[model samples]
Target: MTQQEPAPWDPALAPADADRRLHAPAAARNRDAILSVLRSVLPPAGTVLEIASGSGEHAIHFASALPDLTFRPSDPAPEALASIAGWTTQAGATNVLPPLRLDATDSAWPGTLPPGETPAAILCINMIHIAPWAATEGLLRGAGALLPTGAPLILYGPFRRPGRPLEPGNAAFDASLRERDPAFGLRDLGEVTALAAAAGFGTPEVIEMPANNLTVVFGKQAGR
Candidate 1:
């Protein structure tokens, strides 16, 4: 993708400004809240592999806040990778490493630096629902392979829960996503949990988040 191009899943990447920073208004509003949860859950002093780090806004913000942890932001699109680097440089965030070109549907992610060191956490924010179901399956499979026992795989986004009324806003959002791509829409939480279980992940700890979203954290099962 060219510098001018934007990824289809990255709806928040608006026009860039003078600093080569791509703007995402929603990132500003949600970063702090996300950070609060991350601080409490993320393992201390370890590599964090963030999937679909669009616009790199969250990378800079999270890296700046969690100075002890190294952040590896990644996306499939070239433009998104460039935007990640631009924002990381602009923020002067040393903890934020260079972005990787990672397609979630791929069988596996490229190895991180320093050889065999496993990541302490894998973070995917508002990604799977915007993409295809295959991406979600790939994410679980990759996390199962990469993360150590007890490591966290965190997913944040709107989810359709069993026995819960679908919020009107989420329903509309799901409709819009389906319109964009028939394969993309809010996922059923029960289905996601089952997939995680099959991938050797423990039961998810679900936390309701702002804007009718959820932060679902799954732990890698030991001895699998």
Candidate 2:
């Protein structure tokens, strides 16, 4: 018999409340820092599509902070979708829509968006290194097809940068990730940028984020 794939990370901590809300420790620690960068980059008003929205904590927090923008959070996991719905109901955030069950590797991603809602920007946090490389390729391909010119595709995670040594913490994290799944590990920033460029994105702006992570933003070019 084939061995079952290990669940991603540890089980999330849940509260005593009857709601399906689940908490990811990292989400609480990094939400504010990520929000600070988002405030400057996201458009003033419109929908934002978030891929692999694990635990749904970020979606509620960001929606609460940026009331003008509508947030559509999606994940492939059923538990994550339940958690997102639970958080949305608990927070009473009108700007956040019901979470979609989306898979990054799907070629028909545009069809998954809610009717009459074209995202002004796409945000993916802490996804790349934890999944297979095909997921990243599919994400770029889908974002390229869905976003209009000058729209942004923002990615947040730990990356291996050229000519710079990995911090001790990130190094250990990378090792742990690889140990979890051979396909999982830190991706090189240069390769990621190149992949985005090929998908019709312009040169990315890399920002230094707390906890040795980085936020990379790529703008869709005028012409494909």
Candidate lDDT scores, in order, read: 0.84, 0.87
Instruction: Report clash pairs, candidate 2.
Output: none
- Can you tell me which runs of candidate 2 are displaced by over 4 Å? 1-9, 12-17
Candidate 2 lDDT tens digits, 115-147: 777889999998889889988998999999888
In model 1, the worst 10-residue window by lDDT is 1-10
Candidate 1's displacement at residue 42, Å, is 0.4
True-structure Cα RMSD, model 2: 5.4
Model 2 Cα shift for residue 207 (angstroms): 0.6
In model 1, the Cα lDDT at residue 44 comes to 90
Q: List the candidates' TM-scores in order.
A: 0.92, 0.92
